[model samples]
Target: MKKGLKTLLIIIAVILVITLPIISSYNNLVSLEQKVDQSASNIDTNLQRRSDLIPNLVNTVKGYAAHEEEIFTDIAEARSKLAGATNVSEQADADSELSNALSRLLVVVEKYPDLKANENFIALSDELAGTENRIAIARQDYNKIATEYNTKRRKFPTTIIASIFNFEEKPLYKADQGATEVPKVDFAD
Candidate 1:
């Protein structure tokens, strides 16, 4: 009976030793996943701020350039794409599209001196530019966190734990096409 009890105790100890590290690693993956999710939320909030500013700018420009339907249409279409975006990757793509459309609209505005002089249009433009800056910063932050979390999930023993928990690798939020172009902000004078 003494030998049997000793054997049972040894088996239990071995199981605990084997399972503890796996459990701890799984917990770490969960924590990293939460961090990634929070960062994504932060990016979304800033993007929403930029989206909210578009309507006012569009309306202000429309008041002055009623005949510029193509520009307005482009802005409206881009806004719709952004609003319907389902994920971070989709949002990045839509964001690039919106930027391109806004650039085109701004080019049209160059011909309208009266629109340029409008106080409301200028205020809205400033707001949009500021929000874009915020969004860019927020996107960088999110990407950093996501990279860390993804690396953690993919590394060594953590990868085994992550696989057991079905933790898939997340895609990085990359800038869309033409994102390298310097933003035009000429509120001076």
Candidate 2:
């Protein structure tokens, strides 16, 4: 009886020793993934805030530059694309398009000094700027957490566990092409 009890105890200890690290690793991956998801949501929230601010800004500018109907149409289309974007890449592209349109709108504003000086336009611009900063910070946080999760999932023992659990790699948010370029606004038109 003593020998049998000792064997059972040894088996239990071995099972725990084998399972504990796997459990710990899985829990850690789950936590990191949740953080990444939350950070991504934060980006979406800030983007929505900016989107909400755009209509007011557009209206304010429209009151002054009603003749610039083409730029306003471009802004509307870009805003719609951004609203319909399902993922990071699509959102980035749509965001770049919207930024380009806004740049042209700014040039139009330059032509109308009164719009730039409008109190409503100034307030909306400030709000949009703040939201852009929030989006940037959120993207940075998401990338950092995603990098950590990806690294952890790719490591030796964790890699094996990750594969078994289907812990797919998280994608980093990248800016769209031409996003860094200053959109040229032609005054000659």
Highest lDDT: which candidate? 2
TM-score of each: 0.86, 0.91
Clashing pairs in 2: none
Alpha-carbon runs more than 4 Å astray in model 1: 1-9, 180-189
What TM-score would you give candidate 2 relative to the actual structure? 0.91
Number of colliding residue pairs in each model:
0, 0
Lowest-sum lDDT 10-residue window in model 2: 176-185
User: Per-residue lDDT of 1-189 in model 1, one digit per residue for the tens?
Assistant: 699999999999999999999998988888888888888888788878888888888888888788989878887888898889998788888888888888877877787899898999889988988888888788788888889888998899888888888998877888666568886776554
Tens digit of lDDT per residue, candidate 2, span 49-145? 8888889999999899888999999999999999999987788788888877887887888888877788999998889888888988998998999
Residue 137, model 2: lDDT of 91
- Please give me the total number of clashing residue pairs in predicted model 2: 0
Candidates in order have lDDT scores of 0.84, 0.88
